[model samples]
Target: MSEIGITCTGAAVVNAIFNATGRRVRDLPITLHKLL
Candidate 1:
């Protein structure tokens, strides 16, 4: 049960990281694309 809890917490952290990285990446290209 403790291991499962740790695994779930790790998964949540990874998901949050992915979401933040994705948001930053998605925002970056629009201005460059517009300029180009």
Candidate 2:
């Protein structure tokens, strides 16, 4: 994917996690520690 598309996908993943768990993650690569 293009750069913008990749960024959007990453943002979407972060948003999904926030919506599901009510946690705001501000890091890239979405580590397991961030999930917990």
Candidate 3:
């Protein structure tokens, strides 16, 4: 159960990015171009 909160971490990050840039990133390893 070491990874139980892993999804929450990822979701939080994605949500923060979306809130800041108004973009929804569906892929892993968020990059510069993805936000641009």
* Strongest candidate by TM-score: 3
Q: 1-36 in candidate 2: lDDT tens per residue?
A: 488887699889999999999999998879889888
Strongest candidate by lDDT: 3
Q: What does the lDDT read for residue 25 in candidate 3?
A: 99
Segments in model 3 whose C-alpha atoms lie over 4 Å from true places? none
lDDT of each: 0.50, 0.88, 0.90
Q: What is the C-alpha RMSD of each candidate to the true structure, in Å?
A: 9.8, 1.7, 1.2
Off by over 4 Å in 1: 23-36
Candidate 3 overall lDDT versus native: 0.90
Candidate 3, residues 1-36: lDDT per residue as tens digits? 769888688889999999998999998789999888
Across 1-36, the per-residue lDDT of candidate 1 in tens digits comes to: 798897677556555655765533223223434333
CA error at residue 23 for candidate 3, angstroms:
0.7
Q: For candidate 3, what is the total of clashing residue pairs?
A: 0
Better of 2 and 3 by lDDT: 3
Candidates 1 and 3, the one with greater TM-score: 3
